[model samples]
Target: MPSTLEQLTSNRVKLTVEIPFDELKPSLDKAYKDIAAQVNVPGFRKGKVPAPVIDQRFGRGAVLQEAINDALPSAYSSAVNANEIVPLGQPEIEVTKLEDNHKDVLVEFTAEVDVRPDFELPDLAAIEAEVPVIGVPDEDVDERIETLRQRFATNTEVDRPAQDGDVVVIDLEGSRDGEPLEDATAQAITYKLGSGGMLKGLDEAVTGLSAGDSKTFSSELLGGAHAGETADIKVTVTKVSEQELPEVDDEFAQLVSEFDTVDEMRADIRKALESMARLDQAADARDKVLEAVIGKIDIELPQALVDSELEARRNQVSSQLAQAGLTVEQYLKESEEEAEDEDAFWTEIEKRSLDALKAQVVLDKMADEEKIGVEQSDLSELIVRKAQQDGTTPEQEAQHMMEHNHLAEWMEEIRRGKALAQMVAKATVKDAAGEVLQLDRIQPDGSITDAPAADEQAEAVEADASTDDVVEAPETVEAPAAVEEEAPAEESAEKKPAARKPAAKKAATKKPAAKKATTKKPAAKKPVADK
Candidate 1:
């Protein structure tokens, strides 16, 4: 075998490979056997037909084509290794020469493909980024305490008209143009007034409604049969209940938490919030430092690779918007995004995609240079984190990884993440106050220790892929307050409604269906062999 590489561009290359008859003999023999089993001759049994007879029956070209196809994958892989090229995508292969006379046999082919461009890494120690000072506000701690109070709050039937924060059980009927919409009707549905997760105008319409009171209001259906259509909505309030929160005293503290006094509980809450603030600052530092490093180096990216990434991101965003029944304009408005228009949103997306790709390339190069490797513990930790994020068991996530052949992909993510940590660890990170930040000494509980926490490795694995928040497209949009779902009759009135998070929280939620462990078919290795 003989091969030669030609650099077509900074990020593209062409490889020409020649295979002698002896090198292809194994593939040729297998091809003949396969053809012999598939064809029959007049005097010979099935699979007993000789290669000569099969060649005479089907022409030598057919055998050669099959053998060449069988051999192309190994030949291409070997040529790539021999030339040490990191091809980005599938190659456009052409069989430029083939000779099959009695005395000599040979096959020659060329593959043109995009590849990683060579680039130099800057000094990590010179990189600098400043993150906000970590300060937990009193209001944030109070909010967390209030959340805990709400969890223990008791609901009681109220006699007067319903008010904000009151839970109401009502029968709802929606009709579009005077025609009843089955999907928009439900009975004994429980909703919190002013929660703003149901249909538009629902809060105002039910604000002064007493038990057995009926009110009709016109609003657009958020989901189901009349999604995005305006309908006349009639609500009959069956019950209204007001929540009675217990006083925040020592007894209350003892009941709701491990602390025996309100002061102790408040102290604990403040401590937890401070810890969270520190973690937030650390994450911000990681991203900012990585961004600063990227800004220092210039790398030529292949247009084809950029285009593919952009298309994937576009499709993902489009799918999310479609599922939420929103156009780009509506999503940006409801989400309060800074993008002024759809064009701006997509442009931002393109920029983010390119940045993520560049980050991936840089991290990969650094990993190779530093000889970063994934350990079994790293993989185990990754699986646990993935399981927690996906709301599945570790066993299930492990099965999914194995089923989808994601070990290599995830290992790369881990490797790149470690490389990123190494770079950030060496960089000079500072708070807005100009105090140098020591990331390695930070603990998961937000405490500073003499040594790095045991979980630091796990955190490092996540650092490289944090860009997924920017690059990985949305699976679904945060369901806007403008949307609502029809509840089934079998659902209890006290049951939480099946819908997106309230307008107050815009975090994306995963779909309810458990992820199926789907095994992907391996990609076809046979390249197009034309003679």
Candidate 2:
């Protein structure tokens, strides 16, 4: 096998490869056997048809095409590896030459594809980023405490009209054009007057309505058969009640937490908020440092890759908005984004998508340069973090990871994260007060501490092993099958990029052979399982 690379562009390349007759013999043999099994012959048994006989039935050209298609992926992958190319998208493969004559049998092809361009990393030690000092406001603490108080609050029936903060039990009858809508009717529904998540104008309609008092209002149906249509809603109040929160004292502290005093609880809350602020600051610092690094590098991006990423992001956003039952206009109105119109919103999305791609490329290059490797411990930590984020058990998260064949994807993510952490550690970070920030000591649990010794780390993992079920993942996880870089000439020109193709695992990781977990999935909860 011989391959030659040509620099088509700074971010694109052309690879011309040649496969000898001997290298293609295996594919040719398999193609003949496959075709013979699919076709019936007059005398020869199925799968035993001679090569010349099959050629008489199906042209030698067809056999060669099948053989070439079968052999393309391995050959192209070999060429890519030989040239040390990091492909960014699917290659445009073309069979430039195919000689099947008895005298000279050879196959030659060319692949043109977008690739990652080489760029120098900035001097990370010289880069500096500043974040605001961690300060938990008194109001924030009070608000957190108020939430706990509300959780323990009790309700008592009141002989009075419904008002804000009052929980009212009511019966609803919805009608459109004087016809009753069965789908829109409910009885003995308890609603908080000022909650604001229910029907529009419901709080005003229920307010001042005493028990047994009835009022009618018009609101759009949100779901069911008549979704988006306005209907007349008749509300008959059956009961009104008000919440009585527990006093903010030692007794309340004892009831809500293990703490014995309100002061101790408040102090804990303050500490928790401070820890949360530190985490937020760390995240902000990471972003700022990454942005600074990106700003320092000058790299050309492939337009097609950018377009593909933007399209994917748009589809994802559309899906999320649809799930939330929100249109773009409604979402923008409710969101804190500065984009005021659809055009501006999509423009922002494109910019963010491009930035994300650049960041990916940067981190990938850094990982290569630094030789960052994903260890079993790294994967275990990732699974544990995922479980915490998804509110599921670590075993469940690991099962999901294996079931979905995300081992390689997660490993890459861990490598990139490690690379970023190294860069952030090398960079100078400071707080608003001009005090230097030491983020390298920040632990995965969000606490700032010294790195634990190897034995201590092992012991910690052992302690959590019962709950985490730390998988013994291989150092290298194979990626999902990619699109064949070699294709039939006709099909090669229009093949969708590998990123856009429907994924089918050629060698998916096997699910654990242990008993399946019997814990039922929580309602309205799902793991963020996609890579």
Candidate 3:
């Protein structure tokens, strides 16, 4: 077989192939046998009809057409391989030549599609990025603690008027344009004062109302049969309840947590807050880095990929609408948005989808360049971890996910995360305080570093000090006493006269002093000469 390829576009290719009848013999044989089984012949078993007799009856051109039809796909595929063309979608095949004398078969096809682009990956190591360091404020922890308290709070009946955060049980009736609505009446409905349920004014109508108190307010119903219609709603407060929070003491701590004391509970909460803060910071940092890198690189994405993603996004939106008890048309009608606003919807989805696709391409390229890959063991461990999180057995989860091709997606996510972490580990990261933080202190970077030698040296010194203190206890005491005894003897050998006699007695004093000095000199000289 001989084939020629012509470049149609960046994504499309045209291939013209020619094969001799000898090369197409196998396909012709198979096609003839297939035709024989499907056709009826007198005095012959099914599938036993002779090819030459069938050709005589059906016309030789028709039989040849059937054979060419059967052989075209494989022949085209072979030509594609021979020309090294990677087709995205189906090819448009044309039989350009049909030989009357079983000579050469010429087939021409054009593949209108998108092929994966070939380009060298940008230098990721040279890409500089800053991971934002977000400080977890004290107020954030306090807010989290308050949320926990709210989760544990119980509702209690209150004699006072209803207020925000209080649940009110009420009898309500609504009327639209002086006509009462059957669907807008409730004998007893419990509604939170600020929850924005019922209607916009219903919450405000119930607010400040004590038991047996009633109020009337007008508002528009946003959905249902009375959508966009203004209604006068009368609400009577039957009961008002307020949340009662548990005391924050040791007993409360024991009731809510496994800890025995409030201090221990606070410590645990602090640690949890710190861990969450670190994770949030790491995620924010990763996004900033990706945004920076993406901004620095340029690549053209396949339009086919974008179109496929757009269709997928449309299906997803339709599914969500179906889940919400509405069709896509009904959803658009209810939202007061146009059903034909596909351009607007797809415009937004396409931008996000393209960014996601580009990020994936960048990550995959980086993974390849860095030789970053997820091992089978690592994938298995990840599956086990996810199974534990979802409260299922690893094998069951793995089987379920594999059936849906989610296992591959999960592994890809892991690989991308690992690659991003590797990049972060190599980059310079500083905290809000302008202090460089080690990668281990932030999050797992799929790598480990040994402790510094200075730490080992300090440990060795501490061990030596401890051993010396235990071994030389008696020598320490004797050495101090020996130094004390020598101190006084040395001081006595260096003693001198405190003052000189007056001028009148100088001569007499000088003579005595001279004799004492001579004796001291000899004593000092003896000590010096002994050395």
User: TM-score of every model?
Assistant: 0.84, 0.76, 0.60
- Local accuracy of candidate 3 as per-residue lDDT tens digits, 1-531: 777877766656677777567777777788779888998889878899997777776665665666666666666667767876444444555655555443444333333334434455545556554545645566765565554565566778899999998867788787877788755666766666665535767767787999999999987654444555577888899988896766778886776677888788676666666555555455545555565677777766566666765566556554554444443333344443322554554454445555655666666566667887767875776677667657999998889888986655666666665656555555555566676655444323211235424322212111111111111111100100100111110121111111111211000000000000010111000101100
Please give the TM-score that candidate 1 achieves against the real structure. 0.84
Model 2 has a clash total of: 0
Model 1, 1-531: lDDT tens per residue?
Answer: 699999999999998989889988898999989998888678999888987787778878788888887777778788888998777777877888888873467988888878878888889999999989877677876776666566667778889999998878888888777888786788887787866768788889999999999999998766543356688999999998897766889997787677888888788777766666677677777777778878888988888878777777787777767776677776665575667998988887677667778877787778878988899998887888788768999999999999997787777667777877787788999999999987877665566677666667435325424435322323345645333543321232221111111234222322111111112221233433323
Model 2, stretches more than 4 Å misplaced? Answer: 36-46, 171-189, 193-204, 217-234, 319-325, 391-407, 451-531
In model 1, what is the error at residue 304, expressed in angstroms? 1.6
Residue pairs with backbone overlap in model 1:
none
Taking all chains together, the TM-score of candidate 2 against the true structure is: 0.76
Point out where model 3 deviates above 4 Å. Answer: 1-5, 15-110, 158-165, 170-175, 178-203, 208-214, 220-231, 234-238, 302-350, 364-531
Q: Candidate 1 — which residues are off by over 4 angstroms?
A: 41-49, 102-104, 180-187, 194-201, 218-231, 443-448, 453-467, 470-476, 481-531
Query: What lDDT score belongs to each candidate, Candidate 1 first?
Result: 0.72, 0.69, 0.55
Better of 2 and 3 by lDDT: 2
Question: Cα RMSDs of all predictions?
Answer: 5.6, 15.1, 34.0
